[model samples]
Target: MDTMKRLGGDAFAPQTTYLNSASTGLIPAAGVAAMHEGVQATAAGRPLDHFRDVEAARAAFARLAGVPARQVATGASVAVYAGLIAASLPDGAEVLLSEDDFSSLVNPFHSRPGLKVRTVALEDLADSVRPGTDLVAFSQVQSADGRIAAVDAVREAARAHGARTLVDASQSAGWLPLPQADFLVAVGFKWLMGPRGITYLVVPEDLGGLTPLLAGWVAGEQPWDSCYGPVAELAHSARRFDISPSLYSYAGAVAGFELLDHLGIAAVRAHDAALADRFRAGLAELGHTPVHAPGSAIVSVPGLGARQPQLSAAGIEVSDRAGNLRASFHLYNSSDDVDRLLHSLT
Candidate 1:
């Protein structure tokens, strides 16, 4: 069987057309099974090591994110991780951001008082980093239109300016090879093909000077021993920053990560991007120009958002964002899916 089919064919119905991975990924059958087993174990009150699943998922995410397991902190959402980073910053610190970046990545900084938040065009992100910039935060692959950031340029600028970096990979992980950042957060639902309520945060070796604002018993050096009292000693690593894991969510995430490991990100990226490129070409022939995002797996066409309902009624799945019709191709999507959408648009 083809690799994509081997990984995800049984996850969808025979004629299901899902092109909205940028919105939410279809959880593979393996993930659903794992989650079911977790629930069963819970119902039976059987001794199951839920934390073991969390560790397994965390380690898998660490490998995919190219960071040490000790550097990864399991969380529930990007907003919480962003809040952690926001709390770590000194008052009046200058933060640079992309104006059109996802709200979860943008809103946290605004919520923090006395921080100088500057927003610029996504294309101007690297150039906007100045000497006074304490941190530069943006999404790796933009959710609104799938425009990939110039990560290297931004990293270089941040380094030259002695600034830290925060990258939200919710729209890019599992397919794109992510660059290292001082802080990175990715939700498991989108692109990672896991259930919701699972998020991963990669912090620096020194824990990025972040306070464990939401630390619970899990953040203890010895979690079981520290229950019912303040943690005797916080975890020495980024584990200190961990929020309690959603057990069943981690179970599903571990399965999702296993599939991703077997498929490999490079292969997935090629598969997804090819379908996206095919759709882009067909859009040109149909006289519908999409957002220009070279080498991205998302195709967003402006002024056609009204057609989303028509497409959905015809059993197509896509997103309409800010008056643009967005279609995100994942590993499971094929050229046939691309052509089908193009035909519907015609």
Candidate 2:
């Protein structure tokens, strides 16, 4: 298929101008068809090996993340993986986090008693890493305003200080090239163009010192054999961290992953960023100064959040986050969508 047909022009048909991928991505036609097939199979009581879909999706995500399939753990939420990491930390271990990171990423550490959790400004996060900091955790992209973290700088800082790094790639995964970290977690619903209820965690080859807190039959060396009893042997790889698969969601995820694999992340990134840059230029022409996040696919205009409802009512999909009118572009979006939004704001 051609780029336009494969990416968005033909794969998606949104009634509204969808500029809210940061909120939730629109699953492509292939994903929707796969989901429909899954539902139909379930309704008909057909026997299908959904676990095959799970592993396929897992390997697909691993390819995007530049990791081996053995290092990826499939689950339903990023927070569950975050909690596992939290549970493995020793008491009073000092952790550094961004003040405004998504709560799922930050709250898990807080729930662990006796852990010292320190929050700092996003720009100051790398510098805040001190010798005693045991772990540094933050999102690769700020969900509120789409600020890309200085990942290389922060990772280098953590390495200098002997602090392990955890990055939440939920908002950045589909359109951004993920950096290596001790742990990385992402959900498929937002940018991977997959259904909700599927998330992934990339752990180090040694599993990043995390306990499989939510391990179930799926985490077994032989999942079917491990069911109805204690797992005789846990998976030797990161599969040990897997939660029971959500079969239907995994079906859709497999399709979404296939779509992304065919399109390629670098191509998607360039497409998304270009549209975002177009919107920024349009916003500038309209005399609106957006939040300073150069080269991000998400554009947030300060003090214009109140217009979100107005835009929505006018058939433009966007988000009002932390008092900013946030618009996120994706592989499926185009210059026309950017102009439509700009025209509405005018």
Candidate 3:
């Protein structure tokens, strides 16, 4: 499949190879069209319904997560859910997580007063938790090194230990089936191929009416009522967690979801796995060891800080983290991109 041309010609600039999907995905043409339609409608004083767009985005996100629509909520970012979850916990609560995970999931709790945040190796996530651990928070795929998380094992351990599980699926959801958790969040900008400023949160119905850390009118039963009188009741569904989303972002996210649905996620994952294997093999041939375990889509070549600039000069867009040259494979990447990267490295 010539995904580069099909997904969007505008998304893929000429002579540029984008291998940094882990950072920000190439926004699809569908997303761009959706955003434009929304902007134009509003400018014309005939605004498209914001509620309808957000609900569509939420449903699309739920489909990707393999969860029910009621289980999904739209938020500003993963930090919104992370902070709400953190604030829901009492001060001095013990949270078990990886030091390598993204800061959005960790820093919220760390910045809070009296919380004891304990760092564990990503490989030892399940083993690190024991009884009395209040929460287990981490990413399904580490953003730094792009290691696939053994989250099923962690979930099992968290269940046994009575610890609430929080998964940040920012790097994994569009690439793999999500692991069940008490709370799961994914940004639309990354693998979802949507605009930034949109995030989806999965909150199971069993969690019940959570007190919104940041309350708003939308979360209430009657947002349209001008009484300003009764609190009434918050939504029983994940709608309670929604503070609302950027209208344009929501529109783009809705379109992105539909595009992925048409492409089929299973095929997307297989393509990524193959690309990863090819890139790893190529990197090895270049005498550069891959930083992640076998078959990871995020390939890191450490201590090649200068090599990244040369690749950039050659029109390859990748990332450098902690002195490691990080190249992430997505559905858009082709074998040609891998060949280009490997040839540049040599």
Candidate 4:
């Protein structure tokens, strides 16, 4: 099967090969068209009619994330972090997290008074859980080193310690399997091939003891009621975190989700894993060491002193993040791109 045709024409243009899907995916033409249509719909003064597509986007996101539509909210990953942290913790409660966790997930708890924050190294995760830890927050895949944590083990540990689990799937979603957790947050931009400003917060249906700190108009049960009235009951799922809707982002997400559905996530995952393996093999032949061996779709090859510019001059578009030459592969990337990158490195 030709993967290039599956990625659409926009992804095939020979200007610059995008091996940075871990950073920000290249928006396909279908996504662009969806965004344009969303704008046009709003400009026509029929915003009410746009709700269908908005709901469809929500449902598509939920389906892709393997959760119910109500359990999926659309927002930035930071917003999801804020909502999840606020809804899952109480005053004076401590939330245990890794020292290398994303700053967005840590900042909210750090800003609150009486909220204790503990940071542990990933190597000490099995022994890190304590009795007083209210929530254990970590990422399924570490963005920096591409190290995949044993999420099931962490979840079980957290459960044994009477703590909830919050997972950051920003670097893992759409490319890896959804690990079991109490709550999971994923951004659409990175691996989902969607536009930015959209993310999903998955909350289990049976767990509901905390209240959201930043509830807004769309969060209440009767969101259309008078602005000055009593706060209605919050929704049972992640929609309680929806402060407001971004119709344009929703449309773009719908297109992205459709593309993924067409290609089939299982196939995409297999193709990406193969590509990462190929890239890693090539990088090894060139005497470069990979950060964590290609675990997911992301492969990080550490370059020797100041070799990035030379590699770029040879027509490889790689990112230098934290002193590592990160070469990310997606379904759109072919074996030829890997060969070209290897040729450049040598």
Of models 1 and 4, which has the larger lDDT? 1
Q: What Cα-based lDDT does every candidate model obtain?
A: 0.88, 0.88, 0.80, 0.72
Ranking by TM-score: 2, 1, 3, 4
Q: Across residues 1-346, which tens digit of lDDT does each residue of candidate 4 receive?
A: 7642234435435457667777887676777887887677678975545456667877886776677787776666665555556556678787888776677776777776778888888767757888987887888887765778778888888889998888888887777877877877788887777888777777777534546665676777666762555557776666677757666777676667777778777778777777788888877777777877446777776654256677666666777776777777776688777777777777
Can you tell me which runs of candidate 2 are displaced by over 4 Å? 1-6
Q: Candidate 2 overall Cα lDDT vs. reference?
A: 0.88
Model 3 per-residue lDDT tens digits across residues 182-215: 8899898988888899888898677533567665
Clashing pairs in 1: none
The alpha-carbon lDDT assigned to residue 141 of candidate 2 equals: 94
Better of 2 and 4 by TM-score: 2
Clashing pairs in 2: none
Off by over 4 Å in 4: 2-14, 44-48, 83-88, 226-230, 303-315
Give the per-residue lDDT of model 1 (tens digit) for 222-331. Answer: 88887887888999989998888889888888777887888789888878887888888899999888998999988889999889898999989999998999999887
* Alpha-carbon lDDT of model 4: 0.72
| Candidate 3 accuracy as lDDT | 0.80
RMSD of each: 1.6, 1.7, 2.4, 2.8
Worst 10 residues of 4 by lDDT: 3-12
